[model samples]
Target: MGYIAFTIGFIVFFFVLAFLSTTFSIPADAMLPIGGLLLLVMIIAIAAYAALS
Candidate 1:
């Protein structure tokens, strides 16, 4: 249940970033780094969960 929630939250975060970037004319480069970092963090969290569980 926690994993599911984390996954959903991670996805929503990126989608919101993308939407905001498009709506606000944010530079692709700036958005890419932020999105990438979020994705990286999510991946690490999931991997840690898998390894420890």
Candidate 2:
């Protein structure tokens, strides 16, 4: 349950970052790497939780 909540939080955080990136016209190269890292972290967290469960 905690892990699920954390995953949700991370997703929201990622989207917020994305929104900011777009709204502010962040450079593609920087935004892409950061976004990819965030997504990768989210995936890894979810996978870890699933494996543990």
For model 1, the superposed segments whose C-alpha errors exceed 4 Å read 32-53
- lDDT at 13 for candidate 2? 71
Instruction: Give me the runs in candidate 2 sitting further than 4 Å from their true place.
Output: 1-14, 22-25
Worst window of 10 by summed lDDT in candidate 1: 1-10
In model 2, what lDDT does residue 28 have?
A: 76
| Per-residue lDDT over 1-53 for candidate 1, one digit per residue giving the tens place of the 0 to 100 score | 66785778787887889798989989988888878887887788777877777
**lDDT of each candidate versus the true structure:** 0.81, 0.79
Candidate maximizing lDDT: 1
Question: For model 2, how does the per-residue alpha-carbon lDDT over 1-49 read when each residue is reduced to its tens digit?
Answer: 8667676868797787879788998987888778878778777777787
List the lowest-lDDT window of 10 residues for candidate 2. 2-11
Task: List RMSD in Å for every model shown.
Answer: 3.3, 3.8
